[model samples]
Target: MSTSETTTMTAPNPAAARIPKKTVKDFKFIKEIGSGSYSTVFLAIESGTNRELAIKAVSKELVTRTKKISQVFREKDILALLTDCSYAVKLYCTFQDERTLYFGLTYCPNGDLLQYITDAGHLEEEVVRFYAAEIIEALEQLHNRHIVHRDLKPENILLTDDMHIQLTDFGSGVIMDNNDSPPQSNGTKNVDEEKKPIKRTNSFVGTAQFVAPEILKRGAIHVGSDLWSLGCIIYQMTTGKHLFRGHHEYDIYNAVARVSYKLPDDFPPLITDLVQNLVRLEPSERLGSEETGGMEKLKSHAFFSQFSYDTKWGNLLNQRSPLETKVKLSSRPKLSNDELETMSSGFDDRVEARLIGLRMASDAPNGIDAIVTGSSNISLSNETSSLHETDNQSTLSDQSSTKSMYNSPSSNSSFNNNAPVIARRLQMPDHALSLSEQASKNVYHKFVQNNLIIKQGILDKKKGLFAKRRMFLITEGPAIFYVDPDAMELKGTISWTADLRIEQKDMKTFLIHVPGRTYYLTDPDQDANTWCKSLISIHYRYYNTDPNRKLSTTTSYSSSSSSSAMQTIVPVTEL
Candidate 1:
């Protein structure tokens, strides 16, 4: 029997006909695990079987607003089709209500592959080979059914408890049949068409760095496109960086189109050869392309010579993963009823704060009095008066240093104690720019010029009673600044001195400690490790480059210290 026929005979169907009538009430939601543009995934317990499942709740209103109704249905259809595949996320059932649609999928307690990669910096070559082989098996199953997963990235590859891979997110996928003709060659196009420029798609889909050259060129997407993404993922697995990266999408597209990239000097020759063969500019020339020798050609490569699919494929799930020793799956904490309710509605306050430009404790000049109250109200008059008091107390040397730090000609003088404070109403920029653009222009130009911005992203800063969103920029000056992205105003800066330290409280929460104060911060993307690593790297870079910098006499705290040691350390009241 064919692979498809065997899969059909063995796997149980999870269609609407087989599933019983169910509703959202059938499951008890524990907490939200992940979210996307249109859907939020909640970790829930099935009441009947007491099984943990990840319930992807799609907002019907968002679907209608974004005109993605068809896309939602397509994902459901695709998930149902993949019920037989061990490497794909299994969908048990689907249900909907007045406001939301829910899909109950097998929950992977261990997080996505991105989190693992980020934590480890990069995987060992042996580990990379194991994961790559499983990914190839998954892709073979998809391609056998004529399904093309256009969006393939580490974030979409979830890890199970046993460290096995389960591919998810089929929203961007499409099915191709034998009747579909191959993409036309550049030379075959009409003369008039050749002269016209290639316009970008109205809504660009898929992650920019992993997208294939053919897809960027507006050519027909075939199975070869997936191999390109696989190559990119493998490269990143070996090196803690993207194969093709840029400050903007256009730059990444240009590099991909020209196949412009250099492997790291330390890259192993075997892995490098495998990646080069897979990411060829011409899809047909890729190692696994049908025109070439197909997947067997890739399987026979020296890099994967140790992994014999014929002997190992059936027992792959039983084998222990190499990452099993390195990564430990943490147990999820049980939440109280009040905590659950609070979390369900907690995001609304953030949205309102962003809309009205509510200043947090960190944003104010004095920082203490400007604390956002429980009601989310700020007393601007008191803050302004405090700013005036600070200006009167500033020394001549302090004033000069402040001026030199943030002397922008376009805006009112940068917020310093020596200047009269102006309450500028926050407004959107004239042209819309991505988050990276805003960071480059506002953070780089206004604060650290010439110094490299190591990392910048939105992080929630926990103040006295509430958490407020802020754009954080980490620079090579070994300095960290939290800014109001809307107003492009600098709020406060944290210098990464020798005494500064970081503590990871949990997956999302982390604490930064200076001499007297501790800053409680949380990453919405659950990348606390990345933030801590970047800050530590900057600190090392700064001290190593400048030999004359004196070390402080204050007691230094290590990140590996027990969390119990932080019990007495209070969150910073002032910036």
Candidate 2:
């Protein structure tokens, strides 16, 4: 039997039905690997099977508040439906608690395609073809079941440990009734349906950059909608950038509506043809659409000429991946500082402040008093500062009395009074701090010397193709410092100037343009707007404060046949 026929005949995995009996206690959670608006995915081990699984824990309260209960259940149903599909994530079982619902799925340790592509820069055409074929096959199975994946992007495509592709995240998928006709090899459809210009839908779905033009125009989603997204993913894989990009969602929508884009100068013509064909403005005209030749037409494209669907494609999972040498299994999983802080509730903030104060005192130019009375505009906390001040004062007083007793001729009479303080000091022995603690001291001093911290938090810093988790500290000097949170090491610093510009890329992402480089950062808490506004405000404050600053300008003269001349100079400022 053909692959599609075989997949269609396969029975749903019986394990999906055995739900609700199990509980969270049945599994041992390792650590959280990813999180979304309402769900968090953890690397866990199922006690019953003793196998590694990705357990997705969904917040019941958040889902209800957002009215996404239907989407949650729909995803569960879709995952169950796809249980037997090898190209898709397998659902082992599901269970729930009072506060959260959970899904036990096959763990793909290689991470998602977006991260993979990012780490690898741009994949070779051959590598892209290998992964694309697997995605196409997965889509074939979904379409055969009369399901359209409304949201298909690189983030939704995960890589198995062995590097095979597994299409996941079916929350936006729509399942048509059995009465609806599936896409056929030959171009054929109902006469009345074919006559319509476009199908309409009131609700919008999918990522802004990857959504098809028809979707942006309020057109209903179909199998063709996914093909357009696949094309965008292919472009990103080949070029390492989005095909349609903008600073805002509406800008991206405008670009998609106009079909405005330019390919890289070195882009291969054959790949260009395939991408253009797949992203055609009319959904019905797109390659692989039911009105076209469906999956057969897409497979026949020159870009995937090396693989034969009948034999070679079926065994892709067994073959060695092109990225075999590049892909390395992590020896150990280190929890990020964000994750650590979330898991460690017993971590005392006051204790941390005291530790930091001790370290600061050791490095301060004027001893403990310098740190206690430093000219810092930023305060860690009101309670922390007060506690630190009181502790420092008490220690200093004890030391002063001890010194007086030792140096004075009336020392014998004061001995009893100073003995307890000396004994207390002796009891608190001095020892070397750990590397992380020492590094924290250095970081703290570095911030203090630069006018102290204004705002500090964990954010993802985009470096080349990888997004690294960094502890970022913004200082009163209008400087930005990103540090390795785990190691407490300073990575880089960006000092603000009149030429500096801060741009908000989206709700969570922003860009900092310096003189020579632009830093891309993403906040997990969706606080990019606040970050941008604060940075701009600080920049203006500094600019206005500088009395020695000059209004640097350039002269531009109008060239006209008439002897009249016009000079224009635009003043540069923070945006």
* Candidate 2 positional error at 381, Å: 34
Q: Model 1, range 1-575, lDDT digits (tens) per residue?
A: 33432333344434534544568767766555666656767777766476788988787776665555656665766677778888899889788877778898989989888888877889988789889888898898887766678789888899998899999998877545322353233212333432321211223457778888877876755678899999999998998689996543455778999999999898999999999999999988888878778888888888987764543754667787888887777776656556544433212345325322422333323443322111112111111100111111110111222222223232342222122111111122322232244445443445543333446676767653234456776643345767654445666776455456555545566667555565778776465655654453334333322211222434555553322223212223233
Q: How accurate is candidate 1 locally (lDDT)?
A: 0.62
Alpha carbon deviation, residue 323, candidate 2 (Å): 1.6
Q: How many clashing pairs in candidate 1?
A: 0
Q: What are the RMSDs of all candidates, in order?
A: 14.4, 22.1
**What digit string (tens of lDDT, one per residue) describes model 2 on residues 296-392?**
8888898888664443756777777776666775564555546534342211344335433543354333565433222222211111100011211
- Tell me the whole-model lDDT of each prediction, alpha carbons only: 0.62, 0.60
lDDT of 2: 0.60
> Any runs in candidate 1 off by more than 4 Å, and if so which?
1-20, 178-202, 308-311, 332-575
Strongest candidate by lDDT: 1
